[model samples]
Target chain A: MNPRDEILNRLQQVQRDETLPPPWQSRRDFPELAARFRQALTAVKGEVHQVDSLAAAYDLTNQLLRQMAAEKVVVNDERPLPNLPRLPHITYHQVGQEDETLRAFCASADAGLTSADAALAETGTVILTSGPGKSRLASLLPPVHIALVPITALTTDLFTWAASFNRQLPANLNFISGPSKTADIEQTMAVGVHGPKRFIVILYA
Target chain B: MSNPSSATMSQFRHSATVAIADIQLQGALTGATNKFVNGRITALTELPHANALRDHFKKIRSATLANLAHYLELFEERATTAGSQIHWAQTGQDAVDIVLNIARQHGVKLVTKSKSMVTEEIHLNAALEANGITPVETDLGEWIIQLAGEPPSHIIGPAIHKTRHQVAELFSKEVGRPLPADDIDGLTAEARRLLRTQFLAAGLGISGGNLAIAETGTLVLVTNEGNGRLVTSAPPVHIAIIGIEKICPDWDAAATWLALLARSATGQPMSIYTTAITGPRRANDPDGPEEVHIILLDNGRSQLAGTPYEEILQCIRCGACLNVCPVYKKAGGHAYGSPYSGPIGAVVTPLLFGLEEYAALPQASTLCGACKDACPARIDLPRMLLQLRQDEVAARLLPWRERKAEEFAAFVLGREGRMNFFTKLGRWGQRPFQHDDGLKLPVNVGDGRTLPSLAPKPFRQLWDEGAVE
Candidate 1:
């Protein structure tokens, strides 16, 4: 017999008597969504800044980039603010324009600025998906990741998100909670191992 | 009904001895396991329904396993619809052959990999090397061990046993330069610089599946480091070798599983990256692998279904049992001589591989029940361990000396007269080895545990002499 048939036959004959687990619902609630998101994100060494408006968020992004002395930034030109006003101090290389140049640019770029599709207030997770102009590298390759999150996109948790998720999921959807980190060497915390060293979230109400 | 041993018992005891005697290893294990154990406790306490979540996770795993065939078929159908090519492997070699053939077809010269215990279990890297494909491990712990030519020492943190000095030394040798041991960030930065090239140059990427959500035909991978993202996104072709039992019926089950996994493993609300791959990159998307493949590996996993050991299939590979296990804290991961270690490894290695070959594994535990408590799935490992010991006896896998001692003790402890006589005999025989308050056996026995000598006077003797209160 073929391997699949043999394995299936073996497993089919031996299944025990058990019922499926009862359906679950998320009892978790966030009366203060942005505050909870900030607390949770900041606990993992991720930066969280709440803004009163999108204009304020944009201003903070420019100030933060200028402070870092960032020379180049790869911005994902999709959703929330597809037309982020480029500043003189930072050279913006928008994604999906001649895609081959992305890897090298992201490798050399000082940071990647993007907007999330949704945010999880319970765990302070930002959900990003790949589509027309949202390149995966925009949130990945650079040394720093700056997310512009709108409070209207916030959800309670994964359970709450899954309950109403009806659209087809993209090939790549990432739930990122913090910056890259590892404690492999003698249990010492070392951030910025591979992906972004600094994860800054600008939450706009 | 007898199955003979392929791996001798002496090998098990010897490695355990070496691990116990190495002060460096002892210190590392204590530090790493203690922190993980304490962190898990603190993290779980923050949850309003931590216990309820664990129980629900247990139910989900149990229900999934009991209906493994149904869930697997559903997963295969959905994943196929999503454009993932699913391959079935009845054995480890079969899995390796599938991967090698794929590599050969793509003319892959180099492969970048995220941390996958399944690949380590099958020794996939060695096979890849023999086939002339250089595989680079991108996870920092995995990379350190790969560079040093050592297997992973822990399930979550593979190189926890190695000091920073050792890692610095390994990094220096690899780069042909000296590096300061005190600067961990420098070492990590150097590793990142070196591996970044591998990600861009590699022809293929491989990872293990944490959850194969049958609901949406998704593969969920959780990783603290961003290597998982690079492995899945950077390469043109990607392959995931997943154990057959890693399937969840739907997103609800998968969500609950995720809720308990990172907390139990590394005490995080969630890992840094939890990437869900539905299929190959859409034509409109600018990034991600062009081709996606899933290999469902069943190397002795299906055989445990419906048996007393079926609960072992419920393991999530979180390594919580290891952190809370006293024996694992002492012997470390190397002593098990398997990719898995600690209490979970103790029960799992023997059952999956061969009962006789790994007969000594079941004996490695203290049957403390802490493993069951610590397990996210609440698998009763001690119960399975007892059953394994019984299976060992039935198969007569124990050595002649051990069997004789057990048989003799059974005979003596079975009756009042025999028990009384042996009690006296043991007290007389204890003199030679008796020192202070403990009995020092002639042979090198357990790992630094003391066996107290028998009491000076028997209670029955005192009662007969009217000296008891």
Candidate 2:
């Protein structure tokens, strides 16, 4: 049976057995709720941007693609990785065009870069939701992920700024903060153990 | 039926100690906690009015919890009105029975579950498997652990202990392929494919409620994975296993808690999916479950109400305390041996199971008050821990060595005359053992810093020697 039919049958069974509750309706002030939610998210993300500008700008999709580039270093419109001492490579991936067949992409080019449409300022986290040609794995599986973020998605407090994302959500939404790290080994802080060794974000005006 | 409470307590003792010493556990904990704490601080800086918002949430929560019964009644009424079934389980066994009976009646062969710590605590998966129903874990973290045949160590990041290499290996075996070593995409795709099949074919979907509004009988689940939304809406049978204390009086109270929970646990202002399910699918509603069952499991929570530890119920199970605890860092969640691990686990496991079963957990703390500081609801963890210690002492459950040491210290301090003599001798006699730098010996033996190094001369001797007035 289809999912709907299965659910209907189950509901009917519950009804017959007297196990289900009496039906009730929800009354919500949608407009007011939406407005307040938006206001809160805006404020929160704005503040988060101030604390970690680069992290707030990361777009997981582009970050993953850039890291996969050939040269082990990708420089987008945002700028090149800082010299020093410790510079992780960045690569780029194409949107909607690339074959989803490639299991992994290593940088063929010296440096690749992809920019983000918006950044969430709260917690300096980058938001990456999945869609057509936007592989959710790209946001996660890469070793060093970098995102170029637009300044708009920044908010100070999370609750203040969350309302803007009311648009239909992707099947998966990943909120990434900093590089994947763990202190699991003897309480010593070690970064890039699993997800990413380094995470860089490039924010633009 | 056998009570595993006793066995659980012993396991808790062994694991908690190991957790205290495990360095890798510490690193994982510290990394997540610092990120969260720092992230929250940054987030708060943007909301200068956050204190006011917090106060509003606190007030709302207090009011909701105060009239929890009323809200729960209303919720039941409304949810039934919306064509949903609600069942109350006074204990864990009852909850398990309710879910099993439903599955049996339907002749369910397979069930898909989202991440619900409540199910873990009650060992629901095992129960289903014993009854020949294959229960699959749909959460990424949960799925990995299920493949490894272990319980979750961390609440938020269940597979936090696992390396990508480890995950790839596990997934590769499951998929029967020689997957690439550094292939993150391959692993994720493999998991997604596997879970989708489970999702589509499952006869039952069981989940845990983040919040249950009593007045509306609405159950809310906040998840990042579309799995949660799917688990409840796609499956024919949806059963929610929630603790009795999870009930909030109204939608306003739920909103207040949700506002803080996602942000606190994941730094998300709002989770990707915030589903408020009131009842079974409506006639007009295109999607949602047809049958919805909420099993309210009291377990051991009601016994704690109005007790000193009752404040623990206010905990939203955000796992923030575990993420930040220094001890939990060393000891992974398994070390706690109970479903609830870390500082909160330390207190709750024993209280729920009884003191004799978990005597060692009370002494597990360094009493640094970090857990208490990190708690969103201000569950005075250290105070509760100390109280447990006191109770242990009253019950004469204190280890003999500690009891003897305490008695000796008390006796010495009880007498002023002997104390004065001892104090005088303590200064003069310890001169030979004193180091030039005035540092105590590092070892526990007499050769080491067995006693506090005292001054070469007594206070009176200093006066006699004209070193003091």
Worst 10 residues of 2 chain B by lDDT: B1-10
Write the residue-wise lDDT of candidate 2 on B1-469 in tens digits: 1113342334655665665566655555566667666755655545445555555655554444454455556667877776678787766787899999999988899999988999988889999999999999877778888888877777776777666666778888998887775656456656655776676678899999888766556777876654675577556789999886777765445545765777667655565455667677554332345688988777777666546776677778877788677767766667665677778888887888778777767776789998876665666889889999899889888767778888877887898887778787777766666776564654454333354466656676788789895
Candidate 1 structure quality by residue, lDDT tens digits, B1-469: 0112223478778777888889989999999999999889988998779999989998999999988998899889988888889999999999999999999999999999999999988889999999999999999999999988888878999999999999999999989999999999999999999999999899999999898988778999999889999999999999999999999998878878888899999998888899999999887787889899999999999998888888999999999999999889998887787888899898888877787778789998889899999999999999999998999999999998899989998999899999999998999999999999698997655768779889999888889999988
Candidate 2 Cα errors over 4 Å, as ranges = A1-205, B1-27, B414-418, B421-469
- CAPRI-style grade of the A/B interface in model 2: incorrect
lDDT of 2 at B162: 69
In order of appearance, the predictions have TM-scores of: 0.95, 0.67
Predicted model with the maximum TM-score: 1
lDDT of each residue in A124-204, candidate 2, tens digit only: 555654344443333333445555555554443333334334533333334554544333222223443323444555554
Grade the docking of candidate 1: medium
Candidate 1 regions exceeding 4 Å error are B1-7, B424-457, B460-469
